[model samples]
Each structure stands twice: as C-alpha cells, then as structure tokens.
Target: MKMGWRELIRMKQRFTLMAIVTTLIVLLILMISGLADGLAYDNGAVVRNLPVEHVALSQDAEGQLTRSFLEQTDQPAGTEALGVQSMVLEKQNGTKDDVTVFASPVDTVYGPKELATLKPGQVLVDTQYAKQSGTAVGDTITDFRTKATFEIVGTVSDGRYSHAPVLWTTLETWKAWQDKMKTNYVSAFISQDPIKTDLATYTQQQIVEQVPGYAAEQNSFQMMRIALVLIGSLILTAFFYILTMQKMKQLGILKAIGIRTRTIGQGLVLQVFLLTTVSFAISLLLIWTIGQLLPGDLPFRFEWTTSFGYGGLIVLTAMLGGLIPLRALKKLEPADAMGGMTG
Candidate 1:
C-alpha cells in the first residue's frame, strides 16, 4: 500500500485525470440506474402493492388488462373483480390530467391500502395525485368521460399505474360511469388463494411488463447500463496499460535492486483499487447531493443496495484492468525492461 501511494503521488496528474474520468462514468451509471427504477415504480407501483399472488385475465385478451373483460357471471366465487380505466380528472381550474381509475370492492383484499368502507360517489386518490392537482380531502373532481363528479375521501401512498396516479373508487361508482353493458364486466380478478380456471394467470412481474411502454423503457435503460459498464472497463484498462508502460524503466531498476515481480504487481493492483474506491465514493456523494436538489416530481429513485452492488462491480473491473499490465510485467526481463523497448 505504501509503495502504491508513492507511485500515485509521483504520477499525480495522470492518475487524477483517470480518477475524474472514472468518477464521471460511475455517476452516469448510478443516475441511469435510479431513473430506470423510478420509471418502473411509476408505471407499476399499483400492481406491486397488490396483496394477491396472481391476477387472472381473460384468455382472449392475451394478458392485457385493458383488453380483458370478465362479466359478473364469469367471475369465480370469492375472487375480487377489479375495474380499471384510463380517464381524465378535470381540475376546478379547468385544467385536466390523465389518471388510471381503479374500482374495487371496498375493504376487499385487492384494495391497495386499508381503509374504512368507501361510500358510493366518494373516491380515494394517490398522494402523488393529490399533491399534483392540489386537491384535498372533501374536494370534488369531475370525470371527463361521463361528466360525473366524485368527492375525494382519502389518499393512499404508492398508488400509481401506467405512469399515472391511481384513483380508487367503489364498484358501484364505477358502474354508474360506464355503459350498462360494460358495467357488468371487470378488467381482471384478484385473489389471495390459488385460482383454478381456464383464464390465463400472470404473476405481478409479468403484469408489470404488460403495462404500455414498460418493457421497452426498461430494455433501453438496461442497454445503456451495459454499454456504460463496457466503456468504463475499457477506459480503466487503457489508462493502466499506458501508465505501466511509461514506468517500465523504473520497474526494471527496482527489479535490478532485488524487488520481486510479485511485490510490484501487488502494488499496481493496490493503486488501481485505491483510485477506484475514491472515485466511487465521490460519485456516490455527488449522486446523493444531486438527488436532494432535484424536483419532487422528477422520476429519480435511489436505492443503497443498487449503489453498493454497482460499486462492487466497479472494484472488480478495476482489478481486472490492473491484471492486464501485471501479465505483461510478469513476462518482462529486467534487462529488456531497462532497454525501454515498446512491445
């Protein structure tokens, strides 16, 4: 460690540049990861909060909740039928915003949050919606489709769907807004017990993927993450390779003075490890600081577990980068290294 510190001190300018580059790459990766998770949560928090293990959709709907429709007669006994629709909520100021309306039996297992019996004409909205629209409990919001108005009775946390806030209402209220024929049908079935039926069943994860744009958005972010990892590794490897080459004559002099190749290799690995560790720490601090300054509405979610996991990967890649030069050093003769021939 002492030798590694000495070496870095001697080449402060070059190592500092490498550290800055590494810090930027790591920051980009962590920011991308947070955005990906935030988008996923924004799109699927409602489904993720469901108490059921699986949801049953109509076979002909092909796993799409919006297309699936189950009549009262088709619903299995004891299963909770849920109605979902994309609708607009008209603010008192005449502005409107899109929201996903969810109609479930009050006090049922499928309800995302625990609440008292919900009366007809009253609705519970996600906290995000309440804040965004500046609507409070006892306020009224108009439905753009049916021109029906609902009184906000309460607010629930983490209630979202398809990147929109969820509006929860009683099944009766949902029926009142729908045509008579469609009123009898529900979008899906939720149950804590295992369902035995001909309808297709999907786990929560599969249902999340069924949300519009969910799959595509996640795939793009994943590709970006993979590319960033490759770029960071390549950059670190090249930097270490060039640095090692420049110090070959110094290494040869040390070897002539009886320094073991193993000791020199260990020192190089230690240096890389220290640089990567410092860069990662700096990146993490920057991410946290920026996250604090971001607007509340911005979709950025940070998880310490993810940060630690990626930090470990960065360390591993940095060590691997040092190994490339270590391999060349092992094959070098003291005389050849002193001659400074580029290989």
Candidate 2:
C-alpha cells in the first residue's frame, strides 16, 4: 500500500489534479448529505426525541399540522380535553423573531415548566432559540397579539419543530392570545403505549410520512441526493477512463512483458482505493475546517454514521471509476504498440 501511494505521488501533477477534483466532488456530496440529515433532524428531532409513545393528529387535519387540529377521536381516551391556546412570540432583539408556540395541556407533557426556575408568567423555549435571540435566563417578551408580556423561563435544550424554534406555553395561554376555541388542531399527541387501549400504533416514519410537509421536504432532499450520486458516477467514470488512456502505453508494455491483465487490473484497483482514501480523508478535514468557520445557523451537521456511509460511497465510486478502464484494457491490441502513434 505504501509503495502504491508513492507511485501515485510520483505522478504528482496528474494525480494531484485528479485527487483534487475527486476530493471536491466527494466533499460537496458528503456535505450536502450532512445538510440533508441536519434538515431532517431540524424538522423532527425535538418531537421525535420526546418521551412520548404516540402522536395524535385529527383525521380531518390531512396530516398537515398548520391546517389540522386534533379531533376528539384523535385525543387519548383517558386524557381530558383542553381548550385551544396560541401565543405570539418573537426572538429577543431579532428584527423578525421566528418562534413557534404550541397549545398543550396544562397538566400532561406540555403542562407548566417542570423546572423550579420556570414560572407561570413565562414559558420554555428551545435552547437554539434562546441562543439565537440572545435572551437571558429571565427576560420580558411581549405577546404581540395579546399586548401582554411573558417571561422567559429556564431554557430547554430540546425544542424545535419543522426546523423552526419552538416555545412551550399552556393551552390557556394559546387561547388568551390566539383566540383558538374548541379546536382539535392540537396537531399531534405523544403518549406511551397501552395507548388508551383504543388508538393504533404507527412508526415514526409512518407518522412523519403523514405530515403534510414531510413528504415534499424529504422528496426534495432525496432528489438532490440522487442527482449528486449520478454526477459522482459520471465523474468517476470519466476520470478513470482518461487516466487509463494516458497509461495505455504502460499497459501495452506490461502486457508485452508477460504481465497478466489480472496483475495490472489489481494494480489499477489498488491505485483507485488509495486515491479515494486520501481524497476522502482530506475532504473530511476540509469539511471540519469549513464548519468551524461558519455560523451556527448554517445547516450542515451529521452523525458519525453519515461520514462512514459517505466514505463507503467514495470507495465504491472510485472502484466503479477504475472499472471503466478495464473495458479499454480488453480493447487494447498488443500489435498497436509495435510502432505507431496512438490517440
């Protein structure tokens, strides 16, 4: 492997160019993949991570939270019905603060803040919002519509829905400000199993698919992923073919010397593996450096699984690229190298 690497480095100019090109492509796709994952998490993480068993959305709501309310049927049998509530919230000092308020039961999950630090005059906001808004532990924020002021209680680390910041307030708070009455648009409910013994259980994927924006948002990202994959295949194919053609004489010379095509093929595949390994390593480093330079809002985050997954893809792409040259090798007629200029 070390020898193979040295050979690649020996052809510095050509290998450098190819490596750089491939590295950039890999970096872009991987970063895009990360961003897509980030968006997905941003859209659903808080809700998904909650310690709830099931989510309840009105059958009439058509899976869209904004347009749907919770029907009585959607509510858990044991749970009591709470009137509608909404709040007008804006980020502190932000020209246009974007915060979401949910109508929740005053007792169950969305009830009053669990922390002693939080009081009735205020609500809990996701940590992201507090960081973005520069709001402190306690600050007075106006409910624009109600013309009332609400205090910011202790910060909560987990609170984001549909990729937007969220604020947790009582059902009555929503009603006092938003004028929502007997509305079922409670959107969805989270509960542990033994789920009222009446409601059916649906996986998160099933539930998310039912969400109005879920399919569209996910579809768009999938399309982007598909496009990048195709481009990767093309680039790899083109580069490897060109690299093989440039080394055609070398191949002929090796063939003439009793070097089996198998040996040459192995060498080429090895070369590609080495190239992709180095390129991907560099690309990962680049992404980390770039991430440090960007602001918090930039949507580019991924778990270790994502990087490992992309690395496998990079290797696969390189192998496919190297495979393209094999076809050209089979086409080589040993006689051509006898004494002729070839393109």
Candidate 3:
C-alpha cells in the first residue's frame, strides 16, 4: 500500500487522468439518478405521498386513478373514497396553471406543518403551485371551468400528479363543484389494509407506475444509469489492466524478492479505493453546486443517502476492476520477467 501510494504520488498526471474520468462518470450517474427520482415524484407525488398502502380502483380503470370513475357503491368496504380531478387553476390576472385536485378525508392527505383539518371551502395547495402562482395562506384561488373558489389553508410539500401541482380539499367541496354526474366522481378507494372489494386493487408503487409516462420515464433513466456504471467499471478494469502489463517485470522482481501476490493485490485495490474516494468527493461537490444553481422549477433533487449509496457502488465496482489484473500477477514467471527486462 505504501509503495502504491508513493507510485500514485510520483505519477500524478496518470492518476489524475483516471480520477477525472471517474469523477465525470460519477457526476453523470448522480445527475441521472436525481432526474429519475425528481420525474418520478413529479409524475406520481399524489399517490406516493398518500398515507395509504392500498388503492382500490374500478375494474375497467386498469389501475389508473385518472380513468377510474366510481360511484359510492364502488368504494371498497372499510376504505376511504378518494377522488382526483385534473383541471386548471386560474389567477385573477387570467394566468392559468394545471392542477390536480385530490378530494378525500382531510386526515388522509399529508400536509405541511401549518395544515390542520381544512374547513369546507378551504384547501391545501402544493408548495410548488403556491410558489408558481404566488398563492399563499388565506388567498382564494378560482377554478377555471367551474369558477368555484377555494381558500388556501396551507401548502403540502411534493404534492403533485402527472406533472401538475396538486390541491387537497374535502370531498364535500369537490362534490359541490361537480354539477353533473354527481355520483360517478370517486377516483379510487384508499386504505392501509388490503382492500376486500371486488374492484381491482393496487399498491402505492403499482399506482405510481400506472401514472402516464411515469414507468417509461423511470425505465429510461434506469437504463442510462446502469450503462454509465458499467462503462465506468469497464474503463477502470481496462486502465488498471494496462497499468499492470506495463509494470509486469517490476512486479515479477518484487514477487521473486519475496513480495506476496496477496499483498500486491491489496495494494492495487487500495489504490482503486483511494481514487474512487477522491472522485466521489469531487463529484458530490460538483453535483451539489450544480443543483444549487438550477432553476427552482426544474425537477432536480439531491439527497445524501442516495448520492452516497451510488458512491459506494462505484467504489465496490472499481475495487473489483482493480482485482482483474491479479490473475496475470499470480501467473507471472519471475525468470521470464527478468530475462525480458535484461533483453
């Protein structure tokens, strides 16, 4: 390990080049992972943040809440009926923003610290929507089509659906807003327990996957992340393998002089660990800085646990790549190495 440290220090340019590559790849992976999480949240935050585990949808709805049109009779036994409506919220200035209204028992929808059980005409808006529309507590926002108004009681963090902001209100208010088809607006039935109804049931994750464009978006990001990790691993392996070939005679001389192959292998892996550690540190700083500079409306999020988890995976793969050259090291003929050195 000491020898490897000295070698790395001596060959600054070579190690620095490798570190740069690792850093770039780590940055790409982190960015893609963040985007995946952000888009997933944007597409399904309403379902993801609900304090329920199971959702019972109408048989013909195919697990999609938006397509589910239910009567009170369709609600599963012992579950709360939750309705979702996508519409536009119009500001006094005629500016309009897309909003998905969630109508359920006030206690069922998660809200910010300021929120309590909302009154009949009061509603909780998504923080993103509050920011976008400049709507705050006590402000009344009008529904575009119906011109029905709701007073903002508070804001809910990460409350969105299908890329639109979400507003939470009592089922009574939502029911009053529907002048036609008053009996068929229930979108889904939610419960923490497994639903016992005849309707098709889905878990929270399954419901999120059913959101339009959500599954496909996540799959694409996942594939890109996997590809980047693989490419980083392969590059590490190829670089270290070439490095080992260049140092073959030197390694053989050390082996002949009593150096254990295990110790040599450990040294190489230690180098990989050190390299990845530095690269991860740099990548993390870059990611955080970029995240800070990004527009607030852009769906980007960075979490310590997720970033560190990816870093750990990169380090593990890099160490494994470092070990690939050990086979050649173990099979080297000391005499042949020396003869080639002499030649």
Task: Report the C-alpha lDDT of model 1 over 1-343, residue by residue, as the tens digit.
Answer: 6688898998899889989999999999999988998898888889888887878898887666788888867777668888888888897779898999888876667785443467778888899778877889998889886788888888988568888889888788888777633456789987877777778988878888889889999999989988888888888888899989988888887887898889999899998899999999999999888888888778898878888788779778878977999888888788887785444
TM-score of candidate 3 against the unseen true structure = 0.84
**Model 2 lDDT tens row, 57-90:** 4555454445445554557764433332234564
Show how many residue pairs clash in every candidate, following the order shown.
0, 12, 0
lDDT (10s digit) by residue, model 3, range 1-343: 8878888999999999999999998999999988788788778977887777988888899888989988876666678888888878886667888888888765554333333477777888888778877888888788887788888878878567889888887777778877633444788888888989878889999999999888889899889988988898898889889998899888889888999988888888888999999999999999999989998788888878888988888889988988889998999978777775443
Provide the global lDDT of candidate 1 against the true structure: 0.84
Q: Best-fitting candidate, measured by TM-score? A: 1
TM-score of 2: 0.81
* Native-to-model Cα distance after best TM-score fit, residue 286 in candidate 1, in Å: 3.3
Which structure is stronger by TM-score: 1 or 2?
1
* TM-score ranking of the models: 1, 3, 2
